[model samples]
Target: MDSSDATPAASAPRDPAAPTALRDEADAVLRGLAGETARLREDQWRAVEALVAEHRRVLVVQRTGWGKSAVYFVATALLRARGAGPTVIVSPLLALMRNQIDSAARAGIRARTINSANIDDWDSIQAEVADGLVDVLLVSPERLNNPDFRDTVLPKLAATCGLLVVDEAHCVSDWGHDFRPDYRRLRTLLGDLPGGVPVLATTATANARVTADVAEQLGTGAENTDALVLRGSLDRESLTLGVLQLPDAAHRLAWLDAHLDELPGSGIIYTLTVAAAEEVTAYLRSRGHTVASYSGRTDDAERQAAEADLLANRVKALVATSALGMGFDKGDLGFVVHLGAPQSPIAYYQQIGRAGRAVERADVLLLPGREDEAIWRYFASLGFPPEDQVRRTLDVLASADRPLSTAALEPRVDLRRNRLELMLKVLDVDGAARRVRGGWTATGQPWRYDTERYARVAQARAHEQQAMRDYVATAGCRLEFLRRQLDDEQAVPCGRCDGCAGPRYDAAVDPGALDAARAALGRPGVEVEPRRMWPTGMTEAGVQLKGRIPADEQASTGRALGRLSDIGWGNRLRPVLAADAGDAPVTDDVFNAVVQVLASWGWERRPAGVVTMASRTHGLLIDSLGARLSEVGRLPFLGRIEYAPGAEPAPARSNSAQRLRALAGAFTVPPGLAAAVAAVDGPILLVDDRVDSGWTVTVAARLLRRAGAAEVLPLVLAVEA
Candidate 1:
């Protein structure tokens, strides 16, 4: 939370005379304060000064509770005294802004926020900002993108613009723990300002790659920047890391109950999902532990109440998602229990960093299970794009010399826009492509693909899995393995882990017990076939007519099915019928694509359609067709009139009606053709009359694929699809 409560370490401090240019500027600013500025450590003061004096753009990288805000607060005061005008601070969270504004008010400085609550009065705020009534203005990047504010309010403030500070600057970098697209536009917006405002970027965490990205996004080239790289010693010697590989959720809860009294004064239990957070909190409550739960989905007032309770120690332990600790300051947290594996090392560290803030010994307990990895794998699979799709996308980009807009290139690629965007980002990370203006460009260099990134994300995950194998498989010290992963040198053999705890604890139990239990619960077996059919049904008769209808003439039918079926035609018919054709077997790929397409549309096979009628006869025969010579035409690929008979009108309908019907026609093809198309094993192309909703098609395709269809393709007649 603050420097007063930070743990003391043995790391050497930077030299006092080590290029103190930035230090001198910060000192000058602090000296101008009317009242005493907050006292800071020598190292903190020096880092702040160097940031102010030397770097036109500086990135402050410090650990939590390291007095980061003091550096900027001092600089702001000094700048205002020297007639540098008002400063602007951009943050992503409104709560963080409110906290900073409150802190500044306590320090006797004027600050105001231009967030959702007060944005309606922005015009008047702009006048105050222009008149120098406001010393600092806090706003989120989303609001800054507002056209009116950019065109009107920003220009007025530019006259006295002194500093452009971005807090939590790591959000600007894609590699950062939290990446936001709105942050990307800030560089462009600020660059357009009348005066060249110097920028300062600050964050508690950033690796080398993230640092470089932050510089680029801020439009500050690396050559012109200075970094105050403070390596927060990872040596939290007072904290013990314990990992348990439980057999099931019940077993994990049992372990928690056994260790309840052993837990420190107050603790935070982190869960991966909102459901888990609620479940764990309820379980704890039932067991007589005062607990509170916090998650993103919880209402704001409830979240605030939970946070207040946690801080007041009214709740002995708090079960929460990763959202509880941002900008929060609690000095006496004793333990951080991870209910499941976190996504990454960065996330784990951020959560664990909440504990031991008061320089006291603490504990971090990690409880994982066999199904945890499967859960993580499922999420990873969802995030990863199919290799074939990625390759196809890459090939399309490789063929062009210029970058392509994602929208313009969608038709040229098979993958959806959002999925494609993620794939491109992954490619960029792998150096397969470099993101350019508006799109991505191939680097013409092959990337060494590492499948590990596609697996578990956190270092803790890999460590824990290995530890589990070593303890349960090879019989080793679990505590030692955890200490090794955390870089702890003094970890003695703890006689606690299953391995060290001896035969009674290490006796092998059937790992398949949970699976057996699940099996006994009567879980339904996989049903991919039905799933595939429900999304996209087949009609062979529909196919024959599809080939017969001209693309242009079909385009205006209002529905794709209507265009293919000639649903509303009257009796003034010139029957140009095609002979019966036999059904062909469909391939797996075609079936899958079609299933996907059908799933996209909400169509399923029913007993009453053309396919059902054809199936009853075991084959298809020639029906009837006609052509009208009207001005309206169908699309190019609807079908072709390779040959048609010049037949006379068959019914009482007048010739005028036939003339008015533009190329309206129909045909009867074999029932097997539609069946074959539907039955294709691999993938499917879904053809629909009209796409009123894409969800049905998507769902159907997913079901079909699960049912053993290789692929599904959806072809919809209208844009509604």
Candidate 2:
């Protein structure tokens, strides 16, 4: 996607008074990129000249398809021609690297990438870089923290690299919509670079705050000169943006069902969660639409195949998560429809910007749902841990005799695996810890929590969320609102949006389509597979458990009416499962769904007695569910499993080992329950309000099985995804 139209490239030719030879060479490179007709935009040539002539740090902030990739590729060609080493591009995603590699090849430049997916090629790729056989080398931000690469390959590259490119530069700032801790490590590499090694940081989603932050980081080299930040208007001329607020999840799905193909051409349908992506894909496919699901949950090969299918226009759309957001280059993608609104306007703009890149007109719409806030809160809950949690992680690392992997550290710290890894990466960036060959170790360096900065960041996030709400609610131009959110001084009414020009998409859904959507979403039941093995390092966490859970002690694969993340029952279940929600019996609506799930379960053995797992929050709900099931099935009502005195409930969102440790001896079967289980001839139904970590059920099932029940089948209202 070259910046051939409405860009500085079309503004004017380079100053004739300046060196014309450099501009001519840059134009030749551009022509190779597109065709014989391709020419460098004025700013594109300016950027190349700065790197090749002035050797300056630079930040280019332009909308998607404004030819950010062109500048780097052109500079790379010129630099290699003048006896410079390979350009090292710190990209954020593998898809972006793949796209850039293909784009570079068009300009007759050699490119190679090193990431987790291609470990086998690393040695050969590094050798090529060392031999000056590669013009460009792309690596993910996470690669910078890799022990072997950081210790060996990085230092060598820093000393010899001609130009360093930081793509998706917004990730460098916590103020940015997508802040990645690993990107912060570029400071170390920047400081170690040999003098006069130019650097480039480019992003389309950064606001004034993020741009300033990235520029400051880019100029940290030995010269310490200020980076030239060239931020342009973010308005996309070809996009017609609008918001079509739907009453509920079903209505939104119905709208997509009715209007997906009528928009423009083959495009992407963005969902906020993996479950939503899959759900939307299934619903659209059921309605005879050709589409596939793409998310982090998708396997690498499948994701590649889906991407290829979309590029070739073999499918109408690919329902996706933010996994498809940055660096996906389909020049003629006709539309981008979000199933729900993102929490930030900057992120929303970046996503919708994927459309109309090369086309004269493209539709960009948002089908905001009532469930978006719940999803937002779910993600916001994963922010940086409290100060005490950070100190606990540091103390554990400092005391370890040998480096401990994230898995080993999981049991010692209270954090979940993903969050713990994120915190560890942040610590690595702050110099309080270092990732070594084995895992991570404390540097014993003093580190402050920076409470005020963190608080400010949190406050900024809240403001962004409000801005998104305003973008949805405003009667003003959609594109103008987005541009203003990015601090574009040129923001104004585009005269092309639904707001400025009037509604382009009807809110009405076809009656038949709405019915189909309702039926699809109304369908219930998701399998809740029982825990089969204990987490590693359980013994270190003071639990003797380890290895595969004995089959006889394991609970049979159970069932939940639906996932809390599901677009269907999730809306219904969220309110009931909320922390502030009062304890009560399961609603008739939910109970009927539970009955439908059980009637369709088709368990191998039907004989069962009902049992309840004591819930501190919803004991009444659990007891009622068990009693109703017992009465409905005509099975015995076995007594509840009581928590051992003084054993507090396990914390929410704890890792497997920590959860298991908390539950190991926390439950005991009363004498009556033991006798009843001994007399029971079939499996027992262990009831609970919901399941998060699943250890509570595992422990309770083990206790019941030990008391002589033939099997234990767990049932719950909702399962956390």
Top candidate on TM-score is 2
Prediction 1 TM-score vs. true: 0.53
lDDT for each residue of candidate 1 in 658-716, tens digit (9 for 90 to 100): 21121122122234443443454333333332232233343333333343334444433
| Cα lDDT, all candidates | 0.51, 0.89
* For model 2, the run of ten residues with the poorest summed lDDT: 3-12
Error of 1 at 397 (Å): 17
Query: Best by lDDT, which number?
Result: 2
lDDT of 1: 0.51
In the range 1-721, model 2's lDDT, one tens digit per residue, is 2223222212224344658888898889988888898888777777887788878788899999888889999898899899999999999788778777888898889999998878999999999988889999999989999998999999999989989999999999999999999998999999999998888889999988998888878878646567777778887999999889889988989889989889898999998999889988988998999999999999988988998998899999999999998868898999999988999999999888888899999999998887899888878878888999999999999999999999899889999988898899999999999999999999999999989888899999999999999999999998999999998888999999999999899999898889998888888888999999988899998888889999999999999988888899988898898899989997888888888888999898985689998888899988998898889889989989999999987878888778888899899999999999999888898899888889989999999999998999999999988
> Cα lDDT of model 2 overall?
0.89
**Per-prediction RMSD in angstroms?**
16.2, 2.7
